[model samples]
Target: MVTLRSHTREKARRSTWAFLPPEIRRMILEEISRQRRWSCASTVCKEWHAIVATKNLNRLELNGASAEGLSKIILQRHLVRQIYLNIELPAYTCPQCRGFASSSEHGKLAKDALRKLSKALAAWEPTHHITLELNAYSPNDTDHCFKNHLYGFKHENDGDLLEKQEAWDDQRHGWVKGKQVRLPTTGAIQQLFSTVISGVQGERPQKVPAVKGVVIRRQMRRKIDRLALPKLLKQFPNLESINYEPWRVLFHQPDLLDSSCERCDQMLQDGLPKWPKHVRSVTIFEDFNEQIMEAIRSGIDPTISSTSMQIENGRRTRYGLGEAFAVKSRHLEHLSVSFMIDARDFFTSCKTLSDWPRLRSLVLTTPLMTKGPQHRMSDFLVKAGQVAQKMQRLKSLVIWHCSHDEASAVIFLKNKRSRRNVHGSATLTWRGTRDFDFSEEVVETWQQVVCTCNSHRGYVGQCDSHQLLCRIERVEGEIISHGDAIHHLRLPDGVIDPTSLRQIRQEGILQREARAVEAEPVDGSGEDP
Candidate 1:
């Protein structure tokens, strides 16, 4: 116990980090490197720096880097697996009396960098996944509408939105009421993709071949440019799938939608390659229109497995949802349909869909239910049940009442897919209601008295004990208030937000006493209060 020299030596050994196994140390360093935090971690030692230097790099931002920069970074690195760019291409730029020219000098430089990348990749790995976040560029920045809170400019989520036109659509030509429709500028990305094809020339291939998947993010909220995607597919011969994602899920002004163009028609037709066979998993109204009521009847592949159709402030029948899913009925898998109209229009439009042989899941969000002979919950349930039975492989179905209508109830019913196989039975997960605890006795009695009542009779709600009743009182009890006050969460002023939440015990007594002043008459006893 009195051996100081031995104790000091033991303490020194424990302080050394070398005791960690080589594999374990490498793993920790690799993970940190993937997060692009290698520099911070490498300060510990030379060995860590050496190990971390070779880990897969996070996506390199192409727009921020030049060709030479990319080449140097990717020079000896075997782990550069992905890259992303919010590119504003040269061709899409306005050259003369231009509207939007926020110049991206690297339009051609970007292609060159990709070529260098393609060559580097062909030697080592086959390809890297590319995420192209596409947005229309605007050169003119002096327009105050683009900056400040003017013309809904502050409505955009981009922090630098005050300076840039990446979110340019909000600055419409006719900014108010969308009088003048602003067509999407497709030339820039079109030119970029056109130049990035594989092996067009000698040692230097014109197209960048380093690609496995292309994630296309449409920064502008407009009817999808069907022509733009087909051209992209041709640019990368080896691209397994061309996918689409909105940079932001925007709620578009219904009046501002432009599905066709008088000027871009010839341009759209001029450069489309033969449509290749690929799954059309794009959203309905957001991605396609016109002949695309089936959504791009001629341009995109007919086969589809998953799709989302959200018709805000509109109906599906007008949107021509006819033959949209039906054409690819057998191949359908996942579906999401939300609209403002009654559920009947949606189902009626999709009534042609008697079979969804491979359908796996469905989500239907609406304010109104189907109108049938009796038009009760039973009709809705029966229709839904019938739809469910057709989907032999269906896993989950969600029915949500978005509660956007006046006095409308809110409900979120998620069904357990496994229970569908049971004879005439389905399992639904019911979220809590304000009346849930109070309604138990009523539900139990109703179920016991008429035990013969089944799901088919629309007794599903009471049986499951989750029938929403919030609307019963709201019809006349409601009065309009400030939007923020009603929509946002509120806390009493004197209540400390970050304070200890153990138990206030004394909070709300004052409010209760005030409420008691106007409370119901009560007997002098505890009975019949």
Candidate 2:
């Protein structure tokens, strides 16, 4: 089997790589890893495959991946550091995705798949940062557009085939309804965790496998089951960190409780459940309803109030929560609230931030530039700056979902810098919304090309058009601004246009330069001598 010439040929083939120094080989490997060329590199040789699999394949995202397929991947790459498991209902199926069909097929499938995944993970435990994201949107029916002609369809296990349900708000205006599907329960998700712990116990024999961190994004369908949440924490007593995202569901049903409805006997008897003190971070995205608006406007407690949790304005209410929302989680280091909590209320009610001594990262998001008045937004930002100054341990203050207001961003940056002392321990970033309305001034300043419609008509007046406006300050404000584009185009990062943003910045720079030139002395540099 080993002739001298044949062996020499094999050695020559391998020697190409072996001839290079180990450091040079490592540099080549790093370059491939940086480029995410794992699959290509693995095809080179067995030794290369091993090295690539061990180092480069660190983050695994399993969405609709089969249990057997997942097990093989995990077994091969035991060094995976993070896993994002996204198990969603098939855009259009029940028995197809799940194995059997029933009244509660979706729920059953979720529970079963989760159990199998947990078992697989337990069989081969890797130090992983796990994030579980489950989307509740139904695949078959996503047409939010309302067609007045299409109506009168019977409900079934599958959502109605009709495009939209119609509503006559008064006499003239017609409203189209969005998807009104019920939210899946956390009961199944909680059970999945128990299965994981049990499997870990079986494997370890004496001790359970240690979970590094878990982020759960669970959407509530009906009411948040008070008993289910407490049970989750009770089961996993060792979990030191958890980032929980809770959403109050939206659906249209006769028996469903709206904000206007009286609290049923069951809800009153069940009362509110106290969240565990150990939960390090919590996010609540409330439905935009009259109750929620009132809560933001007049400071009403959302839990006790009968508010229909319906989403509106392409955004949800974030600050319309009850007093007991996260009072127990004193150790919370990271907090993100999207609610329009008043600046005054924050300064007064949120004095407890000092209590959260461990708190470092605070993200507050609100649809201010897009929905609320400019005056209110300015006040809120001012108060946020004040709060940032007081928080001793805060490392980052992220104000997300701000409108593309250069003035506001400049103000925030100025305040942030002003607050920083010798150490300059804190950093703040203003994350503008990708979608922002172009001001009439900016629109007017930009030269317009000849309208295509006018090319045939030989008409040169501003093309008449209308767009879905984000927000208007006054009721008398013009809905359709003249000479402006009808529709707004958005960039990848959510801004309407990067070029327009750059133009705005350039204009500001030019204006400053002009002012500097105007202020300069005529002959010398002396001031009006």
lDDT of each: 0.34, 0.35
Write candidate 2's Cα lDDT for 97-202 as tens digits.
Answer: 2221222444444445545555555544424433333222233322211111111112321342232232222111112132212211222112111111111111
- Compute the lDDT of residue 482 as modeled in candidate 1: 13
How far in Å is the alpha carbon of 486 misplaced in model 1?
A: 17
The C-alpha TM-scores of every prediction are 0.46, 0.47
Candidate 1 lDDT, 1-529, residue by residue in tens: 5689889888888776787788987787777776634456655677875756444344554542343355555443445555654333333323321232222343344445545545444433344544333322332322422122111122443443323332333443213231112222232222211222221233434444555556543223222344444554554555543334321111121222122221223332343224233332322112211111111122223353223322222223222332343334345455443331234334455555666666555544333421112234435544555545555565555443322112122232233335333322322332211111213433332232222346456443433332222111123332121111112212112111111111111111211221212332211111110
Overall local distance difference test of candidate 2? 0.35
RMSD of 2: 19.6
Q: How big is the positional error of residue 416 in model 1, measured in Å on the Cα after superposition?
A: 7.1
**Clash tally for model 2:** 8
What is the lDDT for 250 in model 2? 28
